[model samples]
Target: MRINQFISHNTSHSRREADELIKQGLVKINAKIAQFSDRVKQEDRVFIKDKRIHKKTQFSVIVYHKQKGELVSHKDDRGRKTIYENLPKKFSSWLSIGRLDFASEGLILLTDSALIASALMKSDLEREYYLKIKGHINKEVVEAMENGLEIKNEKKGAHSKSKISSMMIAPFLEYEIFGSSGGYTKLRVVINEGQNRELRRFFGHFDLKIMDLKRVAFGIVELDMLRAGKYRYLEKTEYEKLRDFLRINAIKF
Candidate 1:
């Protein structure tokens, strides 16, 4: 494994943060300052700030049926409810694979392994959502979904403090119209990205207001019958699938 990945997998630091630590000369391999290109073997010793790191060989993951009105955070200055408040004490320190906005309800994956969380968060796996929008699906929407869309002004559905002004949307993997009438449209859509407010921004660009949005799946994991605000460990098959992914990607825990 690369030095940064080794640190990320064995410690609380992210890969990027580990890189920063390396740049600052705080990371060492066998008592020598490590380089970015350095790879670790099983016999190698890795240390951070002079403290040797023990390789972690095991990880845990869980799925949470996140409900609306809960923040995906550990704490908030304004005292809003966070997912940690609802999770068991043992899972409070786990990191989310991605995020569900405060108003969005969905299946969210959390993991005790930073490497696993980073891998899933950055992968081009499919995300499936069920959405209800306050407008009929139009030709423009269909074209954009099929061919992808690029916009220079992409702040419509972004956080007020967000500095992103442009976006490049990739084409949807698949979409199915469930119903369209009564001044609302319901549909299921799949995309292979977790871009910032992607679905919201896409619909918002067309002046279509999303009344409801719920994620039902990510990659090969399905929400199934999980109740809102509840959580469960990944099924055995799901873990097998994840192991395959990690192996294919050359990721080791």
Candidate 2:
């Protein structure tokens, strides 16, 4: 195993943070400052900034109905408000799995298990979003989006190649399938990639404005009977489904 993985499995810090510590030379393996790629055996001694590692709490999961205008991160440099401010005090040490932009609202999953969050954030895991867009949508556009829409002028992260674009099509994308008399239409978008503002940008490519957007489903978890701005614990069956799916797909830390 890698030194960062050992720190993550035994310390309170999340895996992402563990990698940062290793990169910053704050972590030591057998009295030597650790590098991210350093290997460790079961008998190796570990320390984080001179403190010995200890076992962290078991993984816990929660489903939160994020309100609009709340940033998904813990701290906003611009002083914009965040969803963490509204979270219960007892729910510390949990990391958000993926994210919903400040203008979008819907089901956001939080977990103490770094592995689960990382697994769910993988591009292979399917996520469903409910979108309400302005103006009437055309069947050709819907079909195009369902096939794959190329979005220009978007930031591509380090993990992605340059000129990255999201490529998830609506399963039932017929134009006659959706309608709203008030000039707004609703549709469900199922995608595997969770790039920043991807779904909204997809519609924007067709000159469609997203008035409201929310994620209603991820993996086996759905927003059934759940009200807005509330939270609930996931059931055992849902957890099992997520675990089985991750295992079958070879997603592991």
Candidate 3:
């Protein structure tokens, strides 16, 4: 693996931070300054700030049933409740895989292994969401969405003009409509890529308002019976299944 990946896997730093440390001349390999392109071998002696780094023998992964209104970050400037607040104090070192906006809720994965987290993030794994929206949706809109739609960028300032920034093709890999009720419609959407506010932005193109959005699953790991505001360590079988789904072999330190 690359030096940055190795560093991130063995230390508390992120890949970017590892790169920064290397660039700043803080990392050494075999008594030589490490380079960004360097690859680590089992025999190479790697050190950071004169201290040797060792791979973790064990790691932990957890699934949290995040509740709406909770921030995914460790701390919020507005003093709102965050996912870390709901987790046990021992999980302070764990890193969240992805984020759910304050208005969104559901399954969020946390892990102590940056290797696993990084691999999972880089993989094109599918995520499923259940959403409730206002207004009626027809086959034409669905088809258009499935094919792709050009979402225009909103004005940045009061004096700015809106323009077509980019196109958002069928955000959903698969979708099923559960019909409508009380002027609202329920739908399940599966997407391979996790773009920022993608679902909301896609529906906004049609002037449809999203009333509720909750992630139900990530790849092979489903929310299942996990209650909101609660979390649990991933079962060994579940973790193995996730690793296999991501096509990642055993994580070596």
Candidate whose TM-score is highest? 1
lDDT for residue 3 in candidate 3, whole number 0-100: 92
Please give the RMSD to the true structure for each candidate, in Å.
Answer: 3.3, 4.5, 4.0
TM per candidate: 0.85, 0.79, 0.82
What is the C-alpha local distance difference test score of each model?
A: 0.90, 0.74, 0.81
TM-score of 3: 0.82
Q: Write the per-residue lDDT of candidate 1 for residues 1-253, one digit (tens) a residue.
A: 8999788778777677899999999988997899999999989999898999998888889999999999898888989999999999888668899999888999999998877888899999999999999999989999999999997866887777889888999999999988878999999999999998899888888988888989999999999999999999998999999999999999766
Residue range with the least summed lDDT across 10 consecutive positions in model 3: 155-164
Where's the lowest-lDDT run of ten residues in candidate 1? Answer: 7-16
Best by lDDT: 1
Candidate 1 vs candidate 2: which has greater lDDT?
1
Q: How well is each residue in 73-104 modelled by candidate 2, as lDDT tens digits?
A: 98888899887788887665678999888888
Q: Candidate 3: what lDDT? A: 0.81
Off by over 4 Å in 1: 1-8, 11-43, 46-52
